[model samples]
Target: MESRNPVIRRYADFQKPGSVLGNNQGRYDGNVITSTPVDETTQTFPGRTPAKPGERVVTMDDVVMKSFAMLALLLVGAFVGWNAPGLAIIAAIAGLVLGLVNTFKKNVSPVLVVAYALLQGVFVGGISYIYQNLVVADGTNIVGNTIMCTMVAFGTMLFLFKSGIIKVDAKFTRMMMVAMVSYLVIAVISIIASFMGVGGGWGFYGVGGIGILLALFGVGLASFSLMLDFQSIRQAISMGLPEKESWRLAFGLTVTLVWLYLEMLRLFAILAGRRE
Candidate 1:
């Protein structure tokens, strides 16, 4: 089955591969869902046949390149955030809005996607600086370790998917969806608890053993979420989606990566806090 990810699921093309024309949002004139042959009236981009015109199909390379661009922008934003960690809250709110817009928007806007990356990067960098400078007492290089852990998780998941060790079938998707929802509810409760001065203001996650367990769970969930991202990319390319959709896929992947990194960072911080 296709991923339950809102960003990936919005595309009708993913539901019925090659059913829609290779236009923005995979729709034709007036958002019609027709399967009729591409008549001369259909528009093209630059490399397609005369029948379908020159519209280019989505490719792995397109996703890779767009992902790189998004990451670069994020790094730039992270640099700024590292210098001024105070921007974390403002950037986080702004980034959440942009992320939601980019995820559900009908037409993929590369500009907005990259903007989200930059804003989220600020949040990430801000939190990372706090962890490195204020949290760790032993100079454990927690931030660097978190980055390495995130990368390892990514590579491990990719290997599992490629080696056929883990498959994104309907059952797996359903289970992940359920787990995500449950974890979200718990996270909300934990936040409320934290605000109420529970567990030293860390919520359920700051309650020693329970907090560490929850943090580990979060890291695991985020790691597995990467599989769904990978599956979405594969499906998009196989469905022959429009090249512009690459921006959407890249955005989805970036979102997962950011989530994974954040989870890892939190986990490391918790362990370091315990040590302190």
Candidate 2:
């Protein structure tokens, strides 16, 4: 009933006195209380025993399963797109639109979340193929290297978060948001410059040492974003969000991972370009 919980504060409507959400299992009447306790009695009749009712709150297994489902769909889409890189552009556009829709929508939609994952897979696979062709002429397997680095970074962040080494307090969250906004602005400027034929072929991204610096900054931001996502999942579980919201959590993690992967890819590409 405390508003101090971030997840509860965000979803206050779901925690209304009469609402069936959170741990509010019953209401007090003038002379008695109403409750809906689960019936756990096992019957030995011909009919199968009724299954036990599951907890209403989110769980670790729920989050894990949802994430796995999304990842599987993404891999399938990636395979299709990798073989046909021509669909990358369309997939990228569609992914961007779906990402925005999912982020702004009031309620989570499993279909939209899955669609976004699929589109992102296509975009990622296409880009990976292109990047590999560009820098892996000697068969260096840059894509594999990038994936390894991304997973390592993800695991390191998760460990730090679980160990309480990296707390996601208000100050940390604010700082990361400001940093992300600044990075986005710089990226937009670089993109515009590139379209106008500025800074040779790399635009503002290649100005002096900006490319590598920005790439490093982006990677750091993406890693921090992972921490934020993990904290959010913890908060949701603590506040007893509905199990269905697990899909939303999964989508958030997927988005952060994709961003991290792209940043890693860019960093590796910049380093390879410098070597050449």
Q: Which stretches of candidate 1 lie over 4 Å from their true place?
A: 1-5, 8-53
Best by TM-score: 1
Winner by lDDT: 1
lDDT of 1 by residue, 6-78 (tens): 4434432323333333433232322222344543323222222211234566778899999899889888999
lDDT of 2 by residue, 43-158 (tens): 11111111223435457788999999998998898898888888999999999899877766767799999999999999999989987885446666778889999999999999
Q: List the candidate 2 regions with Cα displacement exceeding 4 Å.
A: 1-55, 135-138
Q: Give the TM-score of candidate 2.
A: 0.79
With a 3 Å backbone cut-off (N, CA, C), the pairs that clash in candidate 1 are 45-54, 45-55, 46-54, 48-54
Worst 10 residues of 2 by lDDT: 42-51
